[model samples]
Target: MDLELYQVDAFADTVFSGNPAAVIPLYEWLSDDLMQNIAMENNLSETAFFVRKGEYFELRWFTPESEVDLCGHATLASAHVLYEHLDYDDPVVVFETKSGRLFVDRENGFYSMDFPAWPFHEIQVTERVAAALGARPDKLYMGHRDMMAVFENEAQVRELKPDFRLVAKVDGLCIICTAPGLDYDFVSRFFTPDVSIPEDPVTGSAHCMLVPYWAKRLGKSQLTAFQASARGGVLKCEDLGDRVKLSGQAVTYMKGMIVL
Candidate 1:
């Protein structure tokens, strides 16, 4: 069998600048193992698979190792594929995901994604955490899906070189290190030892936690963010109480067929 695959660089104006995701448009649900294997073969940070489900589509995200509850960049890439490749005429597309309902709308040149805001609480920084990050953060917090380390400035977040082996020992599926940006409102880098992604170039989901924290501290609802990865990403962010809006652009990188 042959499957159509589209690789998209999300949160980027051009190709090779942001997080790249593989999108497979399916007509029906494939077996869990098959999807996971497909994601592993693709070997990207995340691979998105979607099928038409009633009025909206059902979406799932997989890393090389496991399926995640939610993913931001892949969702944006999926929406981009629909609007640009699948000839979707609607301005808005809704998806049913494990994380619940997700909506993406085309506005200007950016794809605006509505995602649930994650809540994290301040935690005492541990020696293990310090060792993993190579530097101690000004503040540390714990959340359901990730642990956040807040630094004093953007340089601290950008200069990090975490030990992925030690990172695996850290609590939570991933670690988010952030600080006030020099050019933008905030800057962040995501490291995941639990998944196949050692460092995500541009993680849109991390902004769900970053936006809320910065909004309360900055005393505003609207913000901008820069992910401090090698392939950096810029995002327009907004905090809306229980939800957050993240807007960015995507570029199609490769279109091909996957033979199974």
Candidate 2:
């Protein structure tokens, strides 16, 4: 069997500056085990597989260890592939995903995605959480998808040196450390030790909760976010009550054929 693979750097203008995701467009559904193995082989943060279903596309995201409910960068990379390489000509691209129906619209060079705004509530900060992140958080929120640790400044968020082993003991899919940004509205870093992603370069899905939180706190609906990783990323965000809009640019870094 043969498969086409494209690696795209999401939320970056040039190559090697953002989160790179492997995208594979398929004609039919491949076995879940095969897809998981492919994701592991690629060793990226997330691998996306999509099949055209009538007028829409069916999308799935997998990490090295397991499949996830939702992923933002991979979804953007898939849309970039369809529009640039696959000759997908449509004003709006719709995808049926594990989370729900997602809509992507292209304008200028940015691809804007509409995603659900996950709800989060305040949670007591425990000693284990403080030990994992190497600092005690000012506040902690238990989000539907992850746990958020709020700090005083962007420097505090950036200076974190998390112990992944200890992070696994904390409850949440991932630990999101965020604070008020120096330039942008907010800054964040994502860590998911259980899924084999120790520190995600630029996590779009984490902004689902961050946007809403910052929007309400800043007293504005439109906001900007910066993911303070080694590669880094910038995102234009908008809070739409129950939904959030994330927009960024993606560039194709490499393309090849995978033989099995």
Candidate 3:
């Protein structure tokens, strides 16, 4: 079997800046082991697979190690493939996913993803948490896949060096450290040793938790977010009651076929 594949850099207007995800549009669902092997071969942060389901697409995301419930950038990348490469003429694309229904809208030069808002609950700052991040956090919280630590400022967020092995044992998907940004509303970094990604360049799902927290704290509906990894990315964020709107640009990097 030969499968069509596209590699896209999501949340970036340019070719090489954002998080790279491999997209495979399959006619039917492949086995879990096959998908894992494909993701491992691609060696990207996430690999997205989709099969058409009536009017919606059934989407699933896999890392090198495991499959995840939700993934932001990869979903954006998949939408890019559908709209640009697959020649999907629709302005709106709907995905039926493990997390539920996800929608993406195409505009002039950007794609906006409507994702579920993940509310965070406050947590105590423990020594293990502090030791993993190599810094003390003023506030700590937990989301579905990560532990969020709010630092004093953006500079602190940028300067953090995390112990990935320790963080992997923290009983979550990853660790997110964030602070107020100078150019945007907030800046963040995502680290997940459990998923084979040491630091994620741009994370869309992380902002789901962030948009709600900052929207309530800053009392604003629309905001800008920056992921402060070495290869950085910018995202436009909006709060929509139960969901968040994440808008960003994607660039197609490569195209190929996988032979099995």
Candidate 4:
């Protein structure tokens, strides 16, 4: 079988500046094992697969090791493929996903994703957490999907030297390190050793928890975010009661065929 594959750089205007995700458009569902193997072969942060279903699409995301409930960069890459290469005429692409229905809207070269907010509550910071992250957090919160470590400044988020093994031992799906940004409203970095992603370049889903927290703290409904990974990303964020809007740009890196 020959499968069409597109690699897109999410949240970046130029190539190699953002998170890269492999997107595969399918007419029928592939076996879970096959998808997982494909994701592993791609050896990227995440691989996105989607199938058209009338007016909507069914979407799924897989990491190198396992499937995840939600992913922001891959979703953005999928939408980019639809708009730029697949001749998707709709202004909005609605996807039925494990996290529920997600909508990606395109306007003026930017794609905005509407995602459900993951609820977060205060959590105690333990010694293991401090040792794992190599810095003492000012505050900690446990979200439905991940655990957040709030720091005092952007330097703390950027200079983190985490012991991935220890981070995996703490709790939750991943560890999110965040702080007030220098130019933007806030900054963050995501690490998910447990789920196989040691560090994600630009994580859209992490903002689901970050937006609400920053909005409540800063007294603003709309905010800007910067993920301080090696290959960084910029995101326009809005807190909408129970939902979050994440907007960014994407550029196609490459297009090729995968033969199996």
Could you give candidate 4's per-residue lDDT for residues 1-260 as a string of tens digits? 99999999999999989899999999999999999999999999999999999999999999999999999999999999999999998989999999999999999999999999989999898998999999999999999879999999999899999999999998898999999999999999999988778999999999999999999999999999999998999999999989999999999999999999
Instruction: Assess candidate 3 and give its TM-score to the true structure.
Output: 0.98
Candidate-wise lDDT, in order: 0.95, 0.96, 0.93, 0.95
lDDT per residue for candidate 1 within 51-133, as digits (tens), equals 99777999999999999999999999999999999999787899999999999999888999999999989999898999999
State TM-scores per candidate: 0.99, 0.99, 0.98, 0.99
- Report model 2's TM-score to 2 decimal places: 0.99
Candidate 3: regions farther than 4 A off: none
What residue runs in model 4 are displaced by over 4 Å at the alpha carbon? none
Q: What is the TM-score of candidate 4? A: 0.99
lDDT by residue for model 2 over 68-150, one digit each (tens)?
99999999999999999999989889999999999998999999999999999999999999999999999999987799999
Looking at candidate 2, the ten consecutive residues that score lowest on lDDT are 189-198
Model 1 scores worst on lDDT over the 10 consecutive residues at 192-201
Q: Stretches of candidate 2 above 4 Å error?
A: none
Number of the candidate with higher TM-score, 1 or 3? 1
Query: For model 1, what is the error of residue 146's alpha carbon versus the real structure, in angstroms, after optimal superposition?
Result: 0.1
| All candidates in order of lDDT, best leading | 2, 4, 1, 3
